[model samples]
Target: MPTTQQAIPFHLAFPVHSLAAARSFYGELLGCPEGRSSADWVDFDFYGHQIVAHLAPEEAGHRQTSAVDGDAVPVRHFGAVLPMAQWQSLADKLRQADTRFIIEPHIRFKGEVGEQATMFFLDPSGNAVEFKAFADIGAMFAK
Candidate 1:
């Protein structure tokens, strides 16, 4: 008998300013299906991972940053690593929606180890989300 390996999905719980805004951003805009919810929080099926957004107005936005590859990368952020094509499609959709990107979609670490396409943007509550893709999936963890 042969054994198959399966990828494990992660669970992340973050604060949001409002549940309505979270529903619109994560559910309607990003296309993540909704799951169980309460008056204070909601769950989103984020690219097969479980992400829960809890209402906490004071803890919603990222205020710190670090310099990375000449960009002020948000110190606190979360997102998915998608295939190249899917990443591009999502980028296009975001552009079409007139999203204000904290880091515009572009190739990062060009001609170097772990080169990839990436973008970053904030949600309605100012939570940072980064989406990225690797030309060669095998190089995702290359040194």
Candidate 2:
């Protein structure tokens, strides 16, 4: 049997079109608690990780997508792997905020490997995030 690994927190920086809108989306809509901030950038505790929104118009315009299970999955996306309950809570919270989703939160691969609750949404800066969770941790990377 393999030992359970400890999940280390991380920090990520991504481009956004508007700092103010990004602030509201992450800090208010998504409910990520606020951290540090400046006129050009803002930080949030994104599911236990530090995610900074930087004002970069050039990077915000382009989006890359790929075909996955007949769905056009955003190629340039980042997200946290949360516990099932936490993931459900986030989905509920987003719905309550009237947040629009690129992909509705749903279970993928029912009764199969890598089955998870997944959803995609763009930040105010246009950066994409796909939050997901596996019911069985051991099957997180199953093929």
TM-score of each: 0.95, 0.88
User: What lDDT is reached at residue 88 by model 1?
Assistant: 99
lDDT of residue 128 for candidate 2: 80
Tell me how far the alpha carbon of residue 62 in candidate 1 is from the true structure, in angstroms, after superposition.
0.4
Give stretches of model 1 more than 4 Å off.
1-5
- Model 2, range 91-117, lDDT digits (tens) per residue? 998898887888899887788778888
> What's the distance in Å from true for residue 103, model 1?
0.4
Model 1 lDDT, residue 127, Cα: 94
- Give one digit per residue, the lDDT tens place, for model 1 in 1-143: 33224588889999999999999999999999999999999999999999999999999999999998888999999999999999999999999999999999999999998999999999999999999999987788778
